[model samples]
Target: MGGEAVQTDITTEHIERLITAAGSHGVTGAIKELGVARTGSIVIDELVFRCEPPRNRHAVPVRIDLVHGTEKAVHVLRLADGEPVTSSEEAPEDACVRLEFDLAELVTLVYGVPRERSAGVHRSELLLAAWPRLTAAYGISDHELMGSVQRAVDSVLGGLSHRRPSLNELAVRYGSDKWSVIHWFTPHYDRHLRDLRNEPVRVLEIGIGGYAEADSGGESLQMWKRYFPRGLVLGVDIVEKHGLDAARLRTVRGDQSDRAFLASIAEQHGPFDVIIDDGSHVNEHVLATFDALFPHLRSGGFYVVEDLWTAYCPGFGGDDENLDNPGTSLGLLKGIIDRIHHEERDGADPDHVARNTVGLHVYHNIAFIQKGVNAEGRIPAWIPRSSDEINPR
Candidate 1:
């Protein structure tokens, strides 16, 4: 050939891998046939999948390539839920969030790296698929949505943050404003931080107790440290044992429900850009703390409370099973979320009237709550005034 088309070297191992997968006998002892195929090298990456139902959410393992973030080639395979839309065909310009996997992300997932923790964006579609199968075998929701429910919320929020303008366009055409409701704080930890100011931003999270103490508070504080290294994070726990490096995060001692205690911290701290309660899950404490310190929140700040199931749990305040003994306070979150959802504030839900349910979700499995400031808000009454003290009955 006058000009040979560039040919790269190939390996027999890569060839055999493909054939083996094609002939791969699945658990049923049948030959495996995947719907799609490609070849690429593995590199450091992560994979996540979220299914909201009427659907369950699951996460795949954390796959880490020992090699540096470099490139390598390997075979690629895919199985789509509905149809295959390749680059040539292009996913039809549509109203749905689409999935696209980099070659490295795909390879790492299929190779099945060992994972110590499998949550957050570290979750993968493969894990989600396998989890249901596993639960089916055990016949239990044992591997319920906890490990990855927040990941699902993250997916929705991530998509919404990117497609706000598209969503507005859809609303104008569809004569429906409901899409905005759907997008609110869907996946948990669904954080949308405002631009960090030149002033050192500080965040104080209360009730870093047990799980929230470990996961939400710890992880969120870490995120602040990472995303806004110039920022400071403080965590307070009831047990006085908050996790994380305390140099950056100061752990305080006091009942999150106690106005005196919370006010003290607020007074000492002066102001905070963000304050989250992962604590008492006690409604009184949540409402009280919000009232006392919310004003201290920086303009456009975020104040979030996690695990709002208490409002509906009879033991907490509403009438639900105490199956898990999530504690009396967990139920309070239900009321808080309900208030946010119904906007049972000063007036009716004018902004939220037709919207009986808020974009806020009641994940029966994990009760989480979130709130953000509206710079232009008239601030509704039902949002809970700090001093509307409801003594625990």
Candidate 2:
């Protein structure tokens, strides 16, 4: 099945073009025609695609069919006047078309990443280009056809400009297109991760979901797994998650905020190349995990903490308006900033954190701590000699 191809009337490229130009319905219809359904609704609007032989074409009744999970299903019902039947059943005498699809293909149809500048082509232009074939398939008077297709195109494009490239195009492709899920952080992530896409690295993510349920978490882990192909993905949560472990993926249940438990994790499964804390966003918990895990990160590795806005909330640690509370994660990170320049100020012996932290990047509600010893030693203390003074000497 890996190298096998599935047959369809439209080329996959054309289907993709339809999807990018026409919208979700284009994807649903194209994928359905390819037998690629899995849990979603397929809407057939008769008025839009009028059938031939005027008797069968009077504002065809709109039908909305629900497709369940992946199973090579196709309903070969007459688009004119027949009910859907299973793949095993013999199609009725007047069956017009067969439609079906599976989960994986549906995901691809909805979330497929296109090449640069490929998705912004004008929908009207696409419709205009395909007009002759579409008109032959659906009997519509040429005089009235443009208006009908223009309305349909407008419905599909959703007011999104499709004529130019956008800065957030990659984010649109990979992050928000698949589900209702929204992770606004993907664009920022793309900046740092573009080069590491093919590397075989270990990524440690803390906080698996499914609150109070043993096997509920791992969505982020799943995303990471797909994004990193060859990389190993490990997840840790406070609850026991079963049935999620598989090749290149491992899960452990432990309190990431606990120093000893965090240390044990490092010894057992870490010294990680990248560590992400999406765990308990409680200020103390964040500080605790960072303190315990930052030292264990491999040199030149990255340590990231998300959801720092919780540090300003009462339940997590500080007063809503306070940004300087020493007890909050943000406050603790401010302390780390001071540590970065400890050599120039009169202070207690520079903390190991100050010595090893080579870069501290603070962004809105997130922080990235890069670990490495500063190989570029301090600039030689400046002392300029005046020419006259040197000559007199």
Candidate 3:
């Protein structure tokens, strides 16, 4: 599994292969592919995993190394008693415990569907000889040190579980507005997205909140990352949001209304499994973005539009008086209904939107458009076109 150079950019395809190998080929096969620099790079990124809080007050440092061939990336997690776990890429001089894992195994543990776990799969080393040095350096008793170590191990191991929190819980934890804040959209999202939870999906969300603030938004992106363990979550905002980029999460600065920019991103990062329009709630922006990105959505994937209440707000180019105005978001959806049934009508050529939209689920202020082949041949063209023709005979 060793390689000559380190892989810098880990693509969605690489992750998919690693997941497939982990499930079908077992540890040896998965590890062999993971040994490549690119795969190893993703496994080593500290941001790819999340650690739980420690129970004790003693600061216990633990080291985890994802090893592939001759290459190894060292990661250290510091669990301070009663504090959140902190991670770093630097290897510690001496840690209370050091865990060594095959690069592929670690990836499987963190991102594999249902998460891979078995008895005696990876290696764990307890640095017993360093205990005295650590105790002396931190001025703690053996009892405290042991307690801290237990808590540290528990915290780290807890994070590697395949079980995920509910979408509402994640939304609240990640500070996303999709929940109780203004909209009760998480439940709807969970219903539509539960099937894709374990998939190695590419999710693109337009409108990274916290306008213009580099580090402010991306709560939903983080939520998506946690919910879809193997997913690559990406966000787009009009402002520069490079601050939010991390392992499996990327941010691009571009206007959602700009078709060219949307097309460019879709070309580079698409055939996306899920594309959400949470950006500017303007009716025009929503319609334009849908036009630009819908084609890039993979078949059977979902395209979500949030905050449809904007369709009635005059400030956002909506007409409360005339809801059927085709320019509004709701108006667009109304038209899609016809497009989806174009085959049933005379002289109706199924356009791109109609041909690809197999299902549409509209909720309170959100809608989920399901992409699939809409060619369920209309009534075999021989079924009675009118009740009068059949009854007259």
CA lDDT, every model vs. true structure: 0.40, 0.53, 0.79
| RMSD after CA superposition, every candidate | 21.0, 13.3, 4.4
Off by over 4 Å in 2: 1-183, 383-393
**Regions of model 3 farther than 4 Å from truth:** 1-41, 46-48, 53-56, 67-73, 81-84, 89-91, 132-140, 380-393
Q: Write the per-residue lDDT of candidate 2 for residues 1-393, one digit (tens) a residue.
A: 000112224332343343342333345455445453322222111111112112232112111222434343333222221222112123322222122333334333333332233442321122244445545666776544555433333322221222322225432422322123434565555555555554555789888776788766666665665455335678998888755664456788888777999999889777787898888888888888888888888777778888888887898775577678778888988888877776655554776788888888877777778778854554445633457655776
lDDT of 2: 0.53
- The number of the candidate with the highest TM-score is 3
Structural RMSD, model 2: 13.3
lDDT of 3 by residue, 35-111 (tens): 55556555544322555546757777788777777777776767775454555665587688887877766766765
Off by over 4 Å in 1: 1-191, 194-199, 210-220, 242-245, 320-393
Q: How does residue 20 of candidate 3 score in lDDT?
A: 65
lDDT of 1 by residue, 178-251 (tens): 12453223233333343442225678877553443343334444334333323466777766554344333456
- Cα displacement (Å) at residue 11, model 1: 58
TM-score of each model, in listed order: 0.36, 0.53, 0.86
